[model samples]
Target chain A: MLILVTGGSGSGKSEYAENTAVRLAKEEDLPLYYIAAMKPCGEEGRRRVERHWRLRAGKGFETRERYVDLKGLALPKRGVVLLECLSNLTANEMFEPEGAGDRTVEGVLAGVRSLAEKTAHLVVVTNDIFSDGMTYDEVTTLYQERLGRINRELAGAFDQVTEVVCGIPIQLKVKGSSVI
Target chain B: MILVIGGAFQGKKEYVKKQFALAEEDFADGAVCGEEELYWARAVLHFHEYVRRCLETGESPEELTALTDRLIRENPDVILLCNELGSGVVPVDAFDRSWRETTGRLCCRLAGEAVRVCRVVCGIGTVIKG
Candidate 1:
């Protein structure tokens, strides 16, 4: 199953996703994978995220820290994969002056689709940018446009789509439910 | 206020500091590594802290809103710096993905508030606003 969690800033989307993933692992007895998308630049970034790991899983969760293409990590067959946020991943892909040429919308869609097919369960967290407001500048406008497109594609692929408001999870889509 | 948006390693912070003649004492700089000492270091560090705070508190929009309000209130020819993290391939992992999103939002928010905005590519600051 693929799940997408989205919300504005301070809405506790990350915490909600983390808690949900933890529950799935502890109660469901499934393997858990937590992938951090932030590039560990210096000592502080690394240490801060390390603290986050200790706090969340108590050193039990298998954590993979990286700043490159994420396809390298193989998803376990019978476990849960939680992608904390989509905004950062998309930004990383879209801002490369040169490498971005290799990444097309079609290619990203294909990858996400394949991942959904391969993973037993996948959860994705993203910021709801539209709710925040709009931008007038070109760079920002371009970023928002691209993010919207990516979000739409992910929403279509995921089996469950939820938006968090004030730390509350509001399910927008579910399997076999057309009310979304 | 001038908002500088560019990719990592681009001298957006340094350029802004030079333009404003802002000294180390005028602003506080926080980075992923620690508190930066130089103007450039502080600038990059500020962006890093912005991202970190958003991630840790899950309060990116609110923090940005407050910052924007503060900048407007201060109105001291502010120059805010940010990394344009959305110009590459989509990250497959959650953490990297979150950073990309947060950075993108930061740039957007800053650009919206900036009287002038520029995107530095190849050491060239191309005007994207004003």
Candidate 2:
């Protein structure tokens, strides 16, 4: 099964997704894996990563750092995998010298498919970044377009799509149900 | 307390007015209201701007959220209208980044305490919490 979780910053979506992944892992007796997307940087960046680490401190998740080119990576065993987010991954693929560049959408999606095939369940976290109502520079706007496309595509493919608002999960799509 | 949030011009204030039966006079515009006014107002609008103003005046994000916590405790029935600012591309300016992050953190805190929470999109209100 594939799950897609999205929300604005600090909306508690991470905690919600983490708990979901942990439950699924326990239910199926599968090893838990967490894919950390953001590359840690300066003092503030490091602090942010540390904060997330603290949140998952005892969750029994083995962390994997895949900055870009996810399709090339492989897991050691079949288990439930939680990708922390898509926003950072999109940014990395768009700007990172070694990223997929213009091929980000297909590249990331292909990577997702590959990962899903290898894991018992894949839970992907993304950002709800289109509703802020702002116009940006050309490059930033292009990034938004690309990320937006990625989110739409994944939501279509995933079994469950949820948007967390103020720590509340609003189901936008549920598998086999078109009325939600 | 009640929280009404959405993107700019999403009719959040109008929703509050119609749904809650509140008059315009009951709202304390966060853009220009005195800090003291926030504690007693029946409702508040442009809350993101209020967060920006506080940051501009040297108030740290922690201080702003703390102040809001106190406001929630003291005025438990107050209705808050805030823009959902953190859903867009991260800003290039340092201040813009801090402002959005602070506003988001504050909203999370407010939503936790609010008796009702509604998100407005395309002028339609979805009750996410109550």
lDDT of 1 by residue, B55-125 (tens): 66675545655754665555546566666554443445566666665555555555556677766666677
Per-residue C-alpha lDDT of model 1 across residues A1-180, encoded as one tens digit per residue = 678888764345676788777776776778887766665556745864675666576634576643335554566556777775566666656665522433635444554565566666778887766632334467666767777887888888677888654334668898766543
Best by DockQ: 2
Candidates 1 onward: DockQ, in order: 0.03, 0.63
TM-score of each: 0.52, 0.93
Chain A agreement with the truth for model 2, given as TM-score: 0.97
Candidate 2, DockQ score (0 to 1) = 0.63
Cα displacement (angstroms), candidate 2, residue B27, comes to 1.3
Candidate 2 chain B: worst 10 consecutive residues by lDDT?
B85-94
Q: Comparing to the true complex, what docking class would candidate 1 get?
A: incorrect
lDDT against true structure, model 1: 0.61
Best model per TM-score:
2
Question: Which window of ten consecutive residues has the lowest lDDT sum in model 1 chain B?
Answer: B34-43
